[model samples]
Target: MTALDNSPNKIPSVTLDDVDSSVYSLYEKREKIFTRSIEGFFQNVRLFTGWPLLLGYFLTPWIMIDGRQAILFDLAARKFHIFWLTFWPQDFGFLAWALMIAAFTLFFITTLLGRVWCGYTCPQTVWTAIFMWAEQVAEGERHQRINLQKAPWSLEKVFKRFTKHGMWMGFAALTGLTFVSYFYGVRALVTDVWHFKLADTALFWSVFFTIATYANAGWLREQVCLHMCPYARFQSAMLDEDTLVVSYDPQRGELRGPRKRNADPDTLGLGACIDCFLCVQVCPTGIDIRDGLQYECINCAICIDACDSIMAKMNYAPGLISYTTENKLAGRGRTWKRPKLVGYGLAVILMITLFSYSLFTRMPLELDIMRNRGELYHEVADGLIRNTYLVKIINMDRKTHTYQLALSGLPAPRMVPDARIVAPAGEVVELSIDVLVDPDKLIEVNTEIEFRVETDDSLWYATSESRYLGPEPIRSQNND
Candidate 1:
């Protein structure tokens, strides 16, 4: 046989005279994420805030103040009730303004501090944490869970899996029911669900939401933040380099490899990191923070806790991974009051001011007047030309009101039968009224008259300026 190196298109064995430090060994398999339990100042803070927030979500539907649900968005009635305020469709502008204010606040917060909402306040994170906690309780800690996954099927394993999934479904069902309860009062919802009297739409939606919650929180926990949520994609636009984000100190963590705890770095020539991989263990998204700041990182700081603990054990200063800015880490002074953040702050302030002013100036009563089209002007007794108009009054308040109507810039304008109309809350009262003017006073076919209405209880007032139809007269006399 011909020598291997002498064969046509055959390559000789290659040797690396100088090994490249940047090149890494490739593994065919992926490592599993076993997030170790961590406890520290920030971890405790997160637990304190996260637990209460979860409790509030599950219990809010049952909470009642003054014989009514504390918060109810009644879609059927087209009313939103929050504490003492009841808003109708006519007051939808308030809702729009409120949404604008919320969007601006989110923008301002995101610009100032990156992904704080996603980390702490997001429902997905909260629900996923709760589900994971339930799983941990049922299946033991991360190590035990990993062991269980590797072990053969056993009665104990089956029981644990069944119990964990059962509890997850229970919590998800509760979440779905509570969400629906806001639209249909909790009491009514409980009664209907208990009696199996749910409408097809309600039952379908409730089941769908329950299934969605369970699958998302229990199964797709990190995937939701990484891929599904639009906020994760758009949040980058709101963030600047000045925004505080969880970052790794590459300057101190580079040349990372397994090393002795107290080994001299001058001899080994390695950075601060001992390559324990504790940060990866604590990350919910299962990413190495030392790799870089990834979009998947929710800035939850669990990795910070884990790394800090590792640093403490190594007798090194904490903050190998920390909440810091690129500039600060790059040896530049950092300030929270950066110009971009300040601009966002000012815009938020302006939007809030405008929203609050609009809310304060909103009128509770509305008047709509339509002039009679069949007969613009009709002759009344004593040579009087009368015009007919229809008035529709809408009341947005929570109480019934009696409104007294009056007409200005007319000889005599009054309601067809009377001058007062009563309108119940969230109801429209449409009635006809007439304005009589003497024929001698008529100089044109349409005369403008201001119609005003004041509630008897002094709650609201409205006005509509409409034209009173009349006859043109004395054309020859006005020729001069």
Candidate 2:
């Protein structure tokens, strides 16, 4: 039995050292990744997804529908046009629901298949892939790129670097111009730039987006995903055991050692993996899948393609590194019926339904009635009570419209000015008019009035409610 040393002299004296936080930094410097090019099922899938995104982004602004850009987010005009529909600032509720739908949809997908959005559909990943391809075309393959990086300053190295950056700049400039076209009409903007007549704002934004695209896709690359993107930080909460993720099958790939092509792994006392680092070489983020699931892994499956190729060459079964579920790997049932996944799916569906309802019920005309707060009521001749109102008619349609205004609540009221308003497309028409009625017709000092606005074509109608203020009735005034 050991006795405790209670005496002060017997106890060992310890002193704490001042630890420099900078000495043990949590941050790791980013190493440039020269991802090896590979062609497989997943690469082909990227082609289908990535090419459409790039092409559609560049071409959609050029598409015209009903003499207007098919897809445009006119921030200056506060109008968003998509195909046949135009959303106004007043319809911002739809935007909120739309964002909710998008967020919940991403959550559902993340819960079902981890980080598939980042791998195949993310703008950063897609654009970065193009930039990487350009780099490879200019410098050469992954090994050649690495060699070029380490090579001393030479004409050939300078030429290769210049060519690579030139391609990136060209694409970035085109992307910027295309992005700006959604705000400024594509044809008009292109013509203006062609003639050196682009507006200062347009030129500024064009240059800004160009530099942004070039930097993000070419230079930042995985750093944007690892550090800047909030999705990577919160994706762990959305992921579940049943979620399909890019992973390495270490159980079937342990005891790693190099083996002859004809040698059996069983006799060599090794696993299926032949210690080839091709998977890590092909990873865009430069992460080793064998190290286990990491937040940095985009689930791009390039590593899977690289490993599959090596497996085929070595006469081994494929999917040594693949998109797989942890539950399946652990020999558990891999059903996707998780609670949070279902909840997210339901939320997405609910948001979609609400957005659809708002869209279908949307009207091209809107009405607003504002009573002059200065004087509640004005007395006129012939014992008449007059109330002034500022009427606003908003034309949200694609074409100009003549709207007719109607007021209700006071009996036999005469509108001093005409009730007709001519509103230009996506413009507001305001009317400062007076409504007069006999004092005997007034039931009370204050009355609720409804304003109805209808387009002359009868295609759209809208209504708003406001208060009508007047003095007490003649009978009540006499009684008082």
Candidate 3:
């Protein structure tokens, strides 16, 4: 209707053109994914593996050894107790090595199986699956639930929604409580919580974890797997064409047009694919593996199971989609003996060896020594010299121990009247001792002395070298 609109070759205003253009159109509102359930080898494996891991996390802390939590990271005391071994802050190198091993192991597994960890054992995936199971129990299956959601609110709908969310929140709190129980003894935590005596830090973290679990697993769901997990972003770098992943065999599934129920592939000039789309229905992450290797594919293989079931019903061979590598599917030679795997294997072995060696050779006791600089050497009232030294001993054990101090290369070091020292299971004990070495025996201003502490068991020993101070020896004039 305007003059510009009437002109055949009129140019549009820059602002008008820019307003119409976009780098990307507004994203379509996402459809909620409703994944169907499937049972198969991989599904069973994931289920069974997840249980033991979950049980270990929730149960290990309560296990006691020598009347103490068996695997406690007593941060308050700066000690880590694992079974019989106790790691103090001084044994931090092994912890670093252990972390390196874990990182490399993740990389190695990623390169071999391609997100198997994410699909099967990841806490996010497992928890989300559990939460969804609860949802499915409360609401009906996929299509029914969708219809229920689209329907107007009613008493039945409200009850179902409230029940589902209420159960989810309760489970989240239990998970949070289990997590915190690892730090605080589970029995103490339970009693303290019931009595309203839980520490602020403990209560704060429990609530934080509860809300996070509820949101991530119940509300956020696949969004966490897709957008929040950094692993999904970096997994591409760790994967190669040879890595086994859940893949759709395009060659065997091309020209996938629908046909008669019993249509023969040879007669119809079609590949084996029947285009049932069951593979798409069972994917928790809501991705189509048929689009080729995608970061969104968690290698869950539920799609493979669904396809296999359909294939069986159609009298066709299974594996139209399967746990396969791009190289193998592309007709390339497959070899599991790649150099990268071998290198990772060697590195894993080396790290394990180093970690074991460090643990085995760890000293049972630690010693620290410092000469009293507050007051330099004090001379006695006679022809004698005395030096003060402060010594601290740490007992790295699950039980208490007593240590007797000794000194060599010095005349005698006496405990000032009552200087006996005893260290608890994981404590540091310090003492001050004075050494009286005869001035006649002094050959130099500073004489070296060896200090030692021996535990009653004779299995632990610590030693350090310090110096005793005295007047410098006078040299006689040279005979000429």
- Which pairs clash (backbone N, Cα, C closer than 3 Å) in model 3? none
Clashes of 2: 0
* Candidate closest to the true structure, highest TM-score: 2
lDDT winner between 2 and 3, please give it.
2
> How many backbone clashes are present in model 3?
0
lDDT of 3: 0.80
Model 2 TM-score on a 0 to 1 scale: 0.91
Off by over 4 Å in 3: 1-31, 408-421, 443-450, 465-480
Estimate every model's Cα lDDT from 0 to 1.
0.80, 0.86, 0.80
Error of 3 at 219 (Å): 2.1
- The order by descending TM-score is 2, 3, 1
Tens digits of per-residue lDDT for model 1, 1-480:
234212211122233545474774573232334456678777777777788887887678787866778788888777788766678787888888788778878888988788888888888988988898898889998768877877899999999999999999999999888878878888888999999998777788789989999999998788789779998998888777778899999998878776767676557898778777667766788878888878988999988898888788777789989999878888988777677688878888998898788777777788889998998689987787878888989887767889998888765554566656888976789988777777765666777789888899766799999988777765535775
Query: Which window of 10 residues has the lowest lDDT sum in candidate 2?
Result: 1-10
